[model samples]
Target: MPRTPTLSFDRGTLILHPPPRGKSWMDYATWDDRVEKFRIPAIQYRQVVEALQAEGSYFSDEAKAFEPLELSPSMEMEPYPHQSEALAAWKLAGRRGVVVLPTAAGKTYLAQLAMQATPRSTLIVVPTLDLMHQWYAHLTAAFPDVEVGLLGGGSRDRTPILVSTYDSAAIHAEALGNRYALLIFDECHHLPTDFNRVIAEYAIAPYRLGLTATPERTDGKHSDLNLLIGQEIYRKTAADLAGKALAEHEVVQIKVKLSQHERDRYNQLIQTRNDFLREAKISLGSLKGWQLFVQASARSAAGRRAMIAHRQAKEIALGTDGKIRILADLLAEHYPERTLIFTADNATVYRISQEFLIPAITHQTPVKERHEVLTKFREGEYKTLIASHVLNEGVDVPAARIAIILSGTGSAREYIQRLGRVLRKGKDKDKFALMYEVVAEDTSEERTSVRRRGVKRSEERGARSEGKVTQLEILPTKQITYGSGDRTSQRAAESSGKWDDNNSLETEE
Candidate 1:
């Protein structure tokens, strides 16, 4: 049972229904006294609030009469042509589907348009607390008459528009699923595997729209989402959306030579991973090992340890001072201007935050604090902020003028999400975005980078093949292989999708 915290409403003397534990003489009676200084321990206040909602405790004559606030006529902001087109697509796509547009393309505006178009009780799932604020503010501003409730890591309310975090929504999905008429999943790509998807299953909202810059998964599968949310109706690339409201950007692939010491540590970690992969393969013959490996890596301490080794090794190669130096160049050149630095680990985030004397945000940061920090960042109070993997997917930080990726989780989904940070439209310039990836030379970082680029390059090709987006130019197919101990060049990387087996390791087959 949740012990209600002592809350002050400035108006009538309001008292929480159920008082906290350790209640002595006065907390015993169920009195309606308004003004009294009291303490309700904060430890499990959420539990108390959740229990109140679960028990239907908040329903009352006065509670129901609080009349929802409404938006003024002057609050309406017209959508751009593309935004209007996206709205048309959303309506035409029937009920449930996902929209792939670059960051800063006014997806929230589109959602608002949908709300007005359909005008049903809607539930918006956000990934972070800051987004909860962003969603509530926009919805409230757009629909001043209606109330917007927020349910994130902590806050949980149910107004006309219920904005929630994905994690919390999934946890109590059985309840939230039935309540809303429409479900709008913002930053939809972050939903990975069955953990989060289970919420979508319970939802009966005939209307569903998912928003993402990159809809593909890190594992390179869109089929799961294609099943839950319908086919991606309108797909717009960052390059396609750039130079308008969004930024036109350049990606600089900064290669850093690893120090011998770091190289030695990285090499050892790779050997362990490769060795484990081999053992798992031998144990589960053919390609069944991949499933077992994934399962093992999913829950076991051993698997987690191995995964850490993989990331730590990659980070050593990727986040070295040499790599940081390259990233620093981007940050320094644009210093005094807003910048976002992303890394694979909290340690690296902390290191950069301390080195530059800037603020940092991670999952470990308190939810309340995150909202404040993001607000400050948006107001340009902080010029630079570094984040561990938390900012990779869904949260929106509007003032990120430049982005630096010193280290990454090696997820193509994550890569695209990190890149999405700076693509939001800016007012000062033609909205230029600078994406810097500091990769260590001659290591798996190079391999990972190639594979990641290849995935995007391939998807763009796939999109072209599907007759959606056309390639700027197509060159004649060509392949070149040098003599012994030489190299090979392939014209198109679309074929790289399949990994060659049989003699994949043969020097000369």
Candidate 2:
């Protein structure tokens, strides 16, 4: 009998001894000149093993050493219809796929269900410490008998079930690659980024699950999730669950105009920025235009000034005084209602917090303080919370029915996540969820507003009313009141008339 090829783990890669020559493995297997053997990334351990087995090639394997996991019966919780549907779809996809369910739709619970089904050593990767801790708490509570580990936020305990931040996972993916049999990515849409992609590619987990409310990215890198984790096996939008699984909802757009002095400064700054762009022959319409602008800004004083002007123009447009006034009125109109206010930048969030005396949570907020703020908000000690991008994903606040988008980017994912913060069904069965978008009229924000709403510019115009709020009723079964010209309604629409049919405002010129 001849000696058959064998596979073994070496550092972060797999070593193939008596390397298979003149075979299909040649495509992925590379000659390790130093070791005098073929090497493959540890991630391909399972793939190569299956291929060799299918080809009737006998191979001894020692790459995977993870322990099998068993879910305690106490850990099981009855899942909702949609959650069950998502899990069924994932299982049908060979337990390696993505689940696209709106936020607060119990995506985390679905992950727990997956753990029970797979019953193997698992690693859950999250994006932020807030999420890492959140998962750690949930996992520890659910699986009391199982030893859960953490690999982020200064913690490096490894157990049968593990939770880690993307940064930490990327830093240690190789060593942990063959340690888990299952991998779960929360908010998996972020997995396609430059360095983070290594976490998925370096893991040898045979089973994978990706969860996200919105899997589409502006950079189109989300498409890579098809291979990085698996295909999107199930998807449900906010609309798909409204009134049944989620609260009934409405989206209101209130337009406002800038003060005269502000408009003058904005126009001047935009003109200055455009002048530089024209002279430098930089067209922002191109894909690489922003990159070009960044590189150019680093090389010349003129470019630096142009960059400052650009920032000023955006601030003036996105943070207009008139919008602040509108926010005040909306806050009053929804007084006593649990509200979440979202802004484009931390400065704006802090400004709102200071002016309104509301609690603010930014990345700069200490973890302990942030937790205290969220706890108070949940306990009704605080009726409102203001944040810039930090609360857009995974924070569950079911009591919140009002969301005020003072300012944000045009990304649909951002808009939807913010909306989802308030979409969770509450005890009030008839409660109507509301989201107010205070947009600056005749500014670059108009286009952004349309983009964020995922509506066509022409359709938006068709529904437009001069200075009046445009209300979109998301649930067909629900009827709510925001009459066109009521006193409070007028207050909401005051000065909005200037937004009339003009749509040519440019942030650059």
Candidate 3:
């Protein structure tokens, strides 16, 4: 009598015993001398199973530890046209891909539709604790009967449906790799980091969904998402759904000049930094130039002076008095229209907050106070709020019609997110959102502004020229059902259709 071949899970890996006699399993497995068996990464579980089935190899699958769920949403709201199209595309892609929709376009609701369509044990990974809690609340409201648990911020309740931060998910990816049938990564751009990538690589979940407003990463690691989650199956920009699902918006750029005294000091600082760089034979134009500068700046007094001069020059460009004066004028012009003030640094945020008597939020702000500030902003108690990068993402900022960017980095994602703060359509459907970009004239800030906006313009042009607008199809507003078992049942589901402000509190994380 011969022993039966079997596949089992072990600490974020798949183990094959009595090694299947074929090249298919070998493609994904390696000989393990210690266990006298073949070991495969859990991520390749789906491919491995399919390969074995294709070759008529019989093996007992003891790796999967999830079951089909009968999930049904309590609410019966109809999905927007774009949302419907995105959901259909994801399904057509075999239920493993990314969906790109602009902020405030209801990406969360689309994930719910996916859950209903597949109805399996699911895990949602988010970048921040705030989002973890927000998803928990939404899931609880949508599925009153299903037990939704959280696994971050010191709470570790493991239920059929779990929400966790990227840190927590990555920390326990081995134990969680086999527990869920579906994995949805919110703000999926964070998935490509060195630490967080393991969460997806270790998971055996054949079904995956990545939701993000911007999928491009500065490090170019976003390409890894193809292997980790799936390809970008669907995408819709803010312009695509403008005036229908979101408010129509416009961006205005304002250039301000530094005073004579300021310009003189700025020139002196720049000259000093350039002298040091020229002597060191370092060109700031290269990709590694900045890193080289940092390394050289720490070894000697001249290097330290050069670094200081570089910092002073940047401060002059980013925080000039002329920019502050223009900000005041803009605030007065747009008085009381629910405005948000954004800056690159906390020093400028606090400066504007104090100078204009507006509330400010930074990473240093306590979580409790931040919540209160946002609540007040939503309720109209606060007309204006100032913030640094903390409000660029995750925070449920109140709907504001006007956004003023005093300073920021060259990141296109940052620019888009700041613009999105005001793009949400409010009760006044006819209202259009306005964003102002204030740049220092004849300074590096001007170039930074162009670099950020250039990427956006290129994206919009590509979207328009390629005609990526998805035609909407009406889907039935009922729970979708699929068969049981892991691989076979997943294929069956693939065939189916369906789908701020300031406040202060002192809390520790």
Local distance difference test scores for all models: 0.63, 0.80, 0.80
lDDT score, residue 499, model 1?
Answer: 31
Candidate 2 segments exceeding 4 Å error: 19-27, 295-305, 426-431, 455-509
Off by over 4 Å in 1: 1-74, 152-156, 171-179, 190-195, 218-227, 264-312, 454-509
lDDT of 1 by residue, 2-55 (tens): 544443221211235344343331332335445434322221222334454565
Q: What TM-score would candidate 2 get against the native?
A: 0.87
Query: Over the stretch 405-444, how does candidate 3's per-residue lDDT look in tens digits?
Result: 9888877678878877888776777879888888765566
Residue 49 lDDT, candidate 3, scale 0-100: 93
> Can you give the TM-score per candidate against the true fold?
0.68, 0.87, 0.88
Q: What is the lDDT of residue 187 in candidate 3?
A: 93
Model 3, position 135, has a per-residue lDDT of 95
Clashing pairs in 2: 467-496
After superposition on all C-alphas, the RMSD of every candidate to the true structure, in Å, is 13.3, 4.7, 13.4
The whole-model C-alpha lDDT of candidate 2 against the native structure comes to 0.80
